[model samples]
Target: MVEFAMLVIVGGALVAMVMIYLRGRSGFRVANPESGTLYVTGVSPRPDATGAQYVTITGNLTGPSVPGTVVYGRMAWDVNDWPAIGDLIPVVYPSGKPERWQLSRPGARPGLGS
Candidate 1:
């Protein structure tokens, strides 16, 4: 009986976590996402005092709407999957906010700088 109750509690927690993740994903779709060439000009030194590594990928947009706008975003520790300098990637943003561009892998991209 106790095992069943514990399973229910764990299941509920997992479900809640999925819901929260989905909710945040909804924001990524709140506005139309634009694609652009990611120009990685720099990357900051990682593993700060908190021992947390962060990668700041910088680039710009070239679509009709946020054309050539300087944009940047950060991601968690040692993302070996991140693109190289002068690589084309997808850039997304909230509605009417070009400066809030985010770098994301479109569909099922596997190769770096592909």
Candidate 2:
């Protein structure tokens, strides 16, 4: 009976470890590219953003050279969709630099700043 109990405990521990590992690798944080533009699949308002409404955008790099690159940024948008934690959005870099992950929507009108 003792041996059986030990086996059960060990199995439970192993299962728990696997779950924890998987959860850690779920890819939640937004990875910014070398450019300033942040590629996000979605956007979400920051908890503290009040007047202007700070936002966190999440999206994969859609640029030709860097595909599948996850990106995120903290900024303010005029829209209401409010990207969620896992949404994906496009990004545009002005100088084509990787570190400049700060980007705006592609083909955004001329008045928008870089």
Candidate 3:
């Protein structure tokens, strides 16, 4: 019984550690943000239940270190304002990490440059 108890405790600890690591990795974002341009590549054929469509966007990194590094992400866009192919949109991403980015909102402070 004691050995079984110990095994359970160890297993629980391992699960907790894995959860923490996974959460941090997905939630990680850099503090110093930089402005980048994202060109619309494609949009989902159907909208979700929320009436939002998944959009595929790709863009080249705009930093000296990762110049020309292309990054891609999928964003949920409103049905009314779906992006068209070849549309350019402003975006902000963490310095050195272009994979994590989001669309830039007007009047909101953008990273690095104003």
- Better lDDT candidate (1, 2): 1
RMSD in order of candidates? 7.4, 11.0, 6.1
Give all candidates' CA lDDT scores.
0.60, 0.52, 0.64
Output the better candidate (2/3) by lDDT: 3
Model 2 lDDT per residue over 1-114, tens place: 999999999999999999889877652333443333233456564554444466666666556455555656676554434455443344544344433455445324212212
Model 3 has a clash total of: 0
Worst 10 residues of 3 by lDDT: 105-114
lDDT of 3 by residue, 8-85 (tens): 999999999999999876655447888777655554554545556675655554543456566777756666565655
Tell me the tens digit of each residue's lDDT in model 1 across 1-114.
999999999999999999999988754553566544455555555443443356676665565455576777776544444346666666566555767766555433323453
Runs of candidate 3 with Cα error greater than 4 angstroms are: 1-30, 46-50, 61-66, 106-114
Ranking by lDDT: 3, 1, 2
Cα misplacement distance, residue 30 of candidate 3 (Å): 4.5
What's the best-to-worst order under TM-score?
Answer: 3, 1, 2
Q: Which ranges of candidate 2 are over 4 A from the true structure?
A: 1-51, 85-88, 94-99, 106-114
Instruction: Tell me the spans in candidate 1 whose CA falls farther than 4 Å from its real position.
Output: 1-28, 45-53, 106-114
TM-score of each: 0.51, 0.38, 0.53
Clashes of each: 0, 29, 0
